[model samples]
Target: MPRDADATKERILAAATAEFATHGYAGGRVERIASQAKSNVRMIYAYYGGKSSLFDATVAEALRRMAENVPPRPDDLAEWAGDVFDHHQRFPDVLRLSMWAQLERPEATAEPSEAYRDKTLAVATADASPLSPVDVLVFVYAIAQAWQLSPAGLTGLEEATDESETVAARRRSVVIAVERMLQKGP
Candidate 1:
């Protein structure tokens, strides 16, 4: 594509990501994405086909970026979990987009991408845990995202004034939990 077209597509994806992350597929608005992207509806349609397609593209792009930015460190699963926690903290929109996708497109979420496959394989090869590789991977991810995904009421740190300290504590907990899980072979 031409430079202008590429820039326009990137803008559309960025706007669509923000829209879908906040509103989900059912509530996301194509017109709003178009307006935020500084592009017209016709161009969005021409580039992405329609609302659903654009949403899918946006989610795919988000996942791709996450995978690229945070590739698993199978040898050091604890630190890997911490990295995952940091990634979610830094890019809360990605987590929101993922939650929206899971809620709105359950069937699509089960399809394993190459990134997942690679992570699973790496875990299986690097660890000697009795638990299955998939289980190990899932547990690490769950622990890493637990604090972020939890309801505000469940997070007892609501009264905390120093957000950085709260985040650091949570991240340390995530790393410790993953390390214990690996050590216990569960």
Candidate 2:
């Protein structure tokens, strides 16, 4: 593909990601994405076949980026959780997109892709513990995402002295918790 075409596609994906995150697949508008991308609506359909396909492509790209940039490190689970948390902080849209997928596309069924299976398998066999690698992963992902929603980690807390302080504290908490889990015995 030409450089210009690739750039245009990226813009479309960016716009589409934001749109899906904000409005979900049911509420997201093709016209709005096109407008945001400064491209014609027709091009989206031409490029992605339709709104559903565009959403799938948008999510696929997000997953691909996560798998590539934050591949799990089974040997160092704490660091891996921190890296995943950082990725979530950097690309908050990915979390929103993931939430929208769960809430709005509950009926859509697709088997886990090979990349996902490999990562889960890697974690499962990386160490011996009462909890399986898959369970540890689930625990880490849940806490990290929950922290994103409430960085203070509990209700009725005063705001942080600095935004980065809250993130640092939350990251530390996640890392420590995962490390402890890794040290547990069956």
Candidate 3:
């Protein structure tokens, strides 16, 4: 589309991301998103076809950003766990969007991300473990996946305490323990 149209689309998606993340799909409204975006409702329909399609586009864009944020190969799994938390650091909204998306649309759970599976399979196969491929796959990925309260992981802890060296050290310790568990035993 034209330059103006493209910019308008981006604005709408940004506004919709915040709206849907907060209120979820059922409660989210197109007019409110349009008002926040500073464009009218027709522009959203013109740019994104409809609200559902716009929501999909917003989610796809968020997922794309998150994929770019993580390590291609998590060689040090504890560090990987740290990195996962680090990836979502400060931006709890991304996690909020993910959780809200899952609750609002259960189908998201079964939607196959072939690229995600392939990256995971590669990591599992590389761990140099005696466990079966499937077992290794589940275990290794699970190590760093952390509690999926949202993409941020363990939202309660982050929200409760202010950032400090002591807290950081404790988080490191916990992640290290989790990583070690994945490494040892079957």
Write model 3 residue lDDT over 1-186, tens digit each, in one string: 445877888899899989988887788899999999999999999888988777777777776666667644545555655666666554556666776777876554334365467656766657744565455444544544444343554555454655566447545754776566666573
lDDT per residue as tens, model 2, 56-156: 88877877788898887877878888998999999999888877877876432132366667878887787645686667777878766767676544733
Q: lDDT (CA) for every model shown?
A: 0.88, 0.81, 0.67
lDDT of 1 by residue, 1-186 (tens): 454999999999999989999999999999999999999999999999999888888888888898899998988989999999999999999989999999997644554388899999998998646789999888988999999889887897466658799889889999999888888631
- TM-score per prediction, in order, is 0.93, 0.88, 0.75
TM-score ranking from best to worst? 1, 2, 3
Clashing pairs in 3: 95-151
Instruction: For model 1, state the Cα shift of residue 16 in Å.
Output: 0.6
Best by TM-score: 1
Model 1, poorest ten-residue lDDT window?
A: 105-114
Alpha-carbon error at 79 in model 1, in Å? 0.6
**Which predicted model would earn the best lDDT?**
1
Error of 3 at 100 (Å): 1.4
User: lDDT of candidate 3 vs native?
Assistant: 0.67
